[model samples]
Structure formats: structure tokens, C-alpha cells
Target: MKKLTNFTILSLFFFSGIMSSCKKDILETIPNDRVSSAIYWRTESDAIYGVNSVYSALDAVNLFVLDGVSDIGHTNTTFTVEFNIENGTYDASHSRIQTEWQNGFRGIFLANDVLANIDKITTTNTALLDRLKAETRVLRAYYYLKLTGLYGDVPLITNPITAAEGLSIARTSQADVYEFISTELAAASSALPASYPTAEKGRITKGAALALKARAHLWSGDFAQAAEAAKAVIDLNVYGLVDEYGKLFTYAMENSKEVVFDKQFLAGTLTHNSFAYMGPYSQRNSSSNFVPTKALADLYTMKNGKEITDPDAGFDPMQPYLNRDPRMRYTMYLDGDPLPSGILFKPVPGQGGADEVGKTQYNTSTGYSLKKYVVAEDLQTPGASGLNFILLRYAEVLLTYAEAKIELNQLDASVYDAINAIRTRPDVGLPELQAGLSQDELRKIVRRERTIELAFEGWRLFDIRRWKIGEQVMRGPVYGITYFENGNPVTIEVPSVTRVFDPAKHYIWPVPQKETALNPALGQNPGW
Candidate 1:
């Protein structure tokens, strides 16, 4: 899909202003200087632009920063708001908490505006109109899915409301919100095409809707429904695992078969600074804002699919990087690993490299740097990274199906097939999971696969929440890589702070204080 250009953004802003304007005298001459709904939303271009505007709210920065709040990743920059979340010190008034709420609603409002005004266009192509409405509904549902995932219960506003009504709106139950999302996605899936042309690659598809529905149901613990939804996506047969796991993230391989849906970007146009935040300090010439934790590294199984802690796994503490999962190298840069710039990544303290821990302000706190999504071009200009951030992928859908089936206790052949497909992907080539395993055993395998397969992709935090394992994983000291020091291996504490994940209050975020303060009807979450 082509990135939204400056012209499209300017046009969207113009239409947004017109949509927000109050009713004017109908008898008076329509002013050319301003556009109103009466004069707008009357063309194909109008509908397309309106829907495209809603896509802008998929903020790359906010989505990518989510990993920092999970066990897999850590935010090293203490000056940033996400660092507070990493340490579990954020509150209702936290800036990131407030923006997540505001941004979600902003997307919902844009979608609602499109849905409310789309009929104004008089087109004989009923198919086109239905597709546009379907797209808008899916987008709106996505925003609600995100909101409810974090906030538990949010005001489910499907229509454009007056300022007075907005101030008085009350929070809706999470169950009802999820039900609405499921219904919308199911209906939208039928109207959307199974695939789009290369020119329209990033547009939402039937698979996207089904994948999201599966995610929502799984998160809600509706295992049977989640499995069914995921199965529907698989049955479509329109997506498959990309041959090269790492290439799936590159600009050259974006919109590949593995990607069900992704946020689009183009260099010098709609871009983000992910490279600057996640890349090695040596390459980006800046401090890495986010770094992987040892907890994440420890999750990667040995090449033979044995746990690294296994006595037979042949893990060498002196050479920790050897004989580990290939994905570990693909996902993160360890000491002595060659970087994209062909320089060895040396994060050991006093190594005199920019990425060396404690070497300078522009150093990694965790002794490791992210390798995923760190394109070579982005390192040259770290602020303008055009790499598309994948929102949904076929691998995730497969894992969701396998997990839901395991939770449902179905234990069918399809479950093994789903997981083995990812395990034995061409580049990964890990040992296939054997069949006839007990449900509890399969459950552990699938969860571990999710952690390693989707690391640094912003799914760990949600997995921690949905699995109710926050207290176990989130409350502890975060550690970095183990390195040999004078013939002894020593694991260093990354941030020198103990994380606190209070199950009583940390499971769900409190309603942002600004929102609750503005609208008293929006009550605080429990134990906030």
C-alpha cells in the first residue's frame, strides 16, 4: 500500500474541519472558503480520504514502545515517560497513559465520522460503498480492541457525539465492547476482499478482520470462539509463513504473505524514529531508548529445541551466544555479533565502543541492542525510518489458533500442524513439536513460542496481561547479558531498579486522570 502523502493528509485535515463545523444557514450561499458536510463527502475520493485519515492514528511510536513495559524489553531512558511504565511507577496522570486514551478515541472519532457521512456520496457502485463502510467498522473495532485491552472498561462510542454528550458518556463493560468488536469484524470480513492489488497492499483485508477477531476472543478467554475465528483465517489459505523470518520485517519484504495487516510508512514521508530508539548506539549515533532484557534472551531455546537450562542443551556460559536459537541472533545483537554495519557489537563496559554499557550517555543499559526492524538505511538517518510496523501476522494467527485449541482441550492434529508450521519455517528450522502431548505440556510450548517468536514486536505486554502472569514476570529485578569478567561470568542488573507489578492494580491501567477529570462519569479503575 502506498504511504499517505502530504496532499492526502492536507485534504483530510480540510474535511475534518468541515465535519466539525456547526450547522450554517441553508438559505445562505455556500461559501467557497469553507467546506461543510453538505458540500463534502459527495465523491469517491472523499470517502477514501476520510477512511485513510483514520489510519493515521496507528501511531508507530506508541505501538513500538509497548514492549518497553513488558518483561521482554526495558526502557533505559529515564527521562522518557515509558521508563516510568517499565519500572511500574506510572499513575493515572502519566503522559503515555493519557495519550493512549486520547489517540484511541481520536481514531474512533475519525472512523465514526466516515461511517456517518459516507452515505452522502451518491454512487451507483454499491460494492464500493459497502467496502468503505466495512473498512471503517474494522478500524473502529481495532481502536476499541486496543482501548479495552489496556483500560478494561472504556466508553464505547460508535457515533459522533456532541461535546456535551462526550462529557457525560459513561464507561461500558469490557464484555460488551468486545462483543461489539467481534460483531463488527465478522460483518466487515464478508465485505472485504481476501487480498488487495500491489498498489493497495496495506488496505485491510478479510484476513485482517478474522485475525483481529481471533485476538479479541483469545484475550477475552473465549477459547472456542477464538479458535474458530483463527481457523477461519487459516482456512482462507491466502497467507503463509515467509521463507526468511528476518526478511518479513524489512521494507523489501513488507506486505508479504506473512503480514495480515501492518501500519504503512515511506521514507521522507510518513516515517517514524524507531531506528533511533531501538538501534545500537554505534550505528544510530544516539542512546538506545529501548533494550532487550535477559529474561527475553533466556526464553530462546537451544538449536535442538531444548531449554537452555537443560543439562543436555550444551549451553556454554563462557560463550553464551553459541549453539542458541538462530532467532536469538536475528532478534537481538549480542557482544561479538556483527552489526548491520559490519562492525562487531561490543556492549561490554569499557570496550570503548559507543554501544558499550556505561561507556557514554549514548550506550545500552542492557548490554544488548535490538536487531529486529533496524534497517541499514534507517541507521544513516535514524529519525526517518520507513519500515512498516506489522500489526497482525500469519505466525501470530497460527499461535493464537494453537493456544486457543490447547485451552479448549481439543488437542487435535490441527493444533500440532499449526505450531509445527512456525517451528519448521525455512529459516527457523527448529525441531517440530511432537503430537500426543498433554494439553498442559502443549500450553507451555505455545506460550514459550509466542514469547520468542514475537519478541520486541509489542505483543509481550498483552500476553502478560491476558495470561495473568504479570506478578510472576513483571515483579522482579531486570537483568542484562552475562559476560565473562576475569574468568567469571557475571549477569548485570540493567536499570538498578526493582519492578513492581501489583496484581491488585497493575493488571489494568487506571483511566487517565485528564479524562476522568473532564468527564466525571469515567470512574477510576479498581485499586488505582
Candidate 2:
């Protein structure tokens, strides 16, 4: 909560590699090629610039925060790329994750510098300085959360040190790392304003800080703390699940009550920085690589309010998406629905590009592709959407609270309220919580709702990890239904390892070999 006085955040920005891409209009004429404290953090404008640099770093887009943890990397269940037996030439696994492990650490290191140096600024207004510090802390906490989740344990560096000092530091245990994350967020939550004024409405708020704390604790398996943190956020009552489910994803409906923290994307200034930016709307829509699987799609319970895993799980898998969670409709563009911007999709005759030979490939198998994060109103825009990516939201908090409550085995009145709030959303029409259900049963229900509600907001990666259900869920020959020209479905197969990983090693990714080599001080996780 202390104000950054003599310390200039802009100095830290220059020292750390200048990698900001958030709001383009607010530019300071700081020479990017040079590193000078006198020239950099001298003006109040410089401080704001520094803060945006931090936001840009923390924001999910410009930096790929959870590249390793998400489905695209390892920990995927049911979708794997098979090794080419004939190719003695090339071998690939999730090595990109290990190679790029520094991205998370780089963000953390920059945040640490900003946080440490903010107090040194002498002429800055006390209130403005504190706000910048708090925002940096929240963003730092986010980077740390991603780090801890992926590696389980990582070096916890609060104060910035020289490269030599950093190299000698060993990794901290996950427990300790999360403790620091919680502590930092708690401080940030208290320091940040209850709400930023209209001009800064989108900035991190006390609620956003607390909401993030709640989720951080939830992911670390600290259920009691998670519940308490979640309670603190709910007490704020500033946010709620959007009345309509689809509104959460579209650009027109950004920064709603449901949105707690998100990466803001605009039409012109900033590129559509989410996974959607890569989505190909037409024939060559190959960039929608970030696809949801059948496991995710099937996890959503039928509107009749029955889970797919239920005794009467009588719904058809062939017509797999029918009567499932309404979120499926909002999230992915399936075979029957019209494409975004009013493009009607006809079934491609074959995998070959004969119909539209050179068009883009939005290869949505079984006629499904991602619609989330694509800006709808920007239909006339020159290129893709500018939808801001939300980092934290009340809906995820609600579910986190529900899951924490269930995990603690105290499904009392408070628990029911949180669960029911989401369950009875206009799209998800399920019966109210039943009495006398076991804790595990409630946990199952919580998990089901998470898959349906928070599917592609980058929640599932941590969700699967926290539940420790990777072994059960991520293994075996995963399958997806690819629709043919006649609307008939053909089963396309993915390799076993792609979908599954060895359970023990799967929960934690291999520590970057480069990191371990450089820092003999660090200890590797069990398997890797």
C-alpha cells in the first residue's frame, strides 16, 4: 500500500525489456533503444507508461502466460499429435513450453522491479503512486500464479536482483510460492481503491485483487483460504454473472459486472490479442487450433438437467452436442449454426480444399469452431476483432467459491447459494441443489459446471490440475466426430500421449532444463 515516491516505474520498464502492447494512444517519447533513469521516469506520464508496460506484460495476450499449462501444450487429454515413425529426422513433444518457460519468469521479474522501485519516486502524487504499485502487484501475482501452477514450485523473487543473483537462486516450494502470491494480493487488494474512477474504470480494483486472491488460493489447494478470499470478494458484490451466458465473450459486452479482470482489445489501435485473433473465419480457418474437445463439450449437462455421466445419460453422442450445456452453442460454432458476421457454413465435402481451394481453414471438426473472444460488432472492421481478454471474472469466482466449499465438505446454505446462482443461469437450467448429497457428488457437479461455464477462458488448465483428475481424464485414445459432406460423422483419432500423460509427471510440467542448467541452486520436480 506504500506509495512509490522516488522510484520510477518507467526505469524498471526500460531495464526490463520494453514489451508493452495494451493501449497504444498513451505513448511517451522514451527512447526504446536507450536505458536512462533521468530520461525515462522523470514525468508523471512516464509513470503511467510504466504501469501500462506492466499491464501489457501481465495481460494474457502480449505475453503467453500459461502456454505450458493450457490444452495447447501438455496436460491435454484425448488429443495428441502422433509421432511420425518414418521421420528419424524430427522429434517434437511439448518442448516449446520448456524452451519458452522464461516468458512467465520475465513478466514476474519485471513486476518485481517495478514494485521494488516504485517507492523511490519522490515527486509523484501519493495516491497515484499507490494505485500504480497496487496494479503492478496484482499483475505480478498473476504471473506468479501462472508460474506456480505450471511448475508447482518456482523461485519466489519479491525484490529485484542482478542477473548473477537470480541465477544462483533455487526454486521455492509451491506452498511457499502460493503463500507469497496470497500475501502480495492481500496487500494489493487493501492498497487498491474500492473502485477506480470513471476514467480508470477498467483498471484493477480491490474486488479484482480479492477475486484473484480467491482463485490463487483455490488453485493452490488452500480451500479454507480460498473460501475466505472468495467470501471477501462476494462481500464486495460489485460483479455478478451476466444474465445471458453469451455476453461474456462478445466485444460489444465487455467490462460488464461479470468481468473482473481482462485484457482490453480495441478495433484499430490494438490487434485482437486473444486466441481468437488467430481464428480463420473462412476456408483456411486453421488458427482456431485452440479448440475444445468432446470431453469438454460432453461434460455440460443436458437442459433436462441431467449430467452426461448420469445413469440415464441417454443423450446421443453421435448428435453429441444436442441438449447439452447452452454454453456449447455460445462457445463453439457447430455444424448447424451460422458463422460469425453472418457467414453460413456448409459442410466441407472433404478434408481437401476443393470447394474453396485456397481459402483459410477454420477446421472445426464435427462442424464446430470457436466463437468466443471474436468481436461481433466489428463485422465491418478491416481485420479481426479487438475484444479485450478478461483475466478474472465474478462467474469464475463464484465457481471457485462453490468448488472450495464443496472441497471443504461444508455444503451448507452459503454453498447452495453460490452453486445455484450459476446453475440457474438462463442458459443452464438445472434443478436446485438436492439435499443429502455427498461431498464428492457436489464436487462432480462443481466440475461439470466449470467445464460448461468457464471452458475456454483459460480456466480448464488449472481446473484439471487442481482436481488432480488428469490421469483419469487426460489418458487414452481421445476421439472427435468430424462431419462429412452428407452431415454424417466420421471418427478422427488422435494419439494416446497427446490426450494423456503419465499421471505422476502430468500434474507438474518438467522444469525448464535451461533453467536448471543455469541455476544449479534449483531443484527439479519429481519426474522431470
Best by TM-score: 1
Model 2 ranges off by over 4 Å? 1-35, 59-95, 273-286, 309-320, 346-362, 365-367, 377-384, 482-490, 494-498
200-239, model 1: which lDDT tens digit per residue?
7777899999999999999999999999999999999999
TM-scores for the candidates: 0.96, 0.83
Alpha carbon deviation, residue 425, candidate 2 (Å): 1.9
- Look at candidate 1 and give me any clashing residue pairs: none
All candidates' lDDT scores? 0.85, 0.64
As a whole number from 0 to 100, the lDDT of residue 175 in candidate 1 is 97
So what's the TM-score on candidate 2? 0.83
**For candidate 1, what is the lDDT?**
0.85
Per-residue CA lDDT of candidate 2, range 367-422, in tens?
A: 34556665446545524456667778887888889889898888888887898888
Weakest 10 consecutive residues of candidate 2 by summed lDDT:
82-91
Error of model 2, residue 116, in angstroms = 2.7
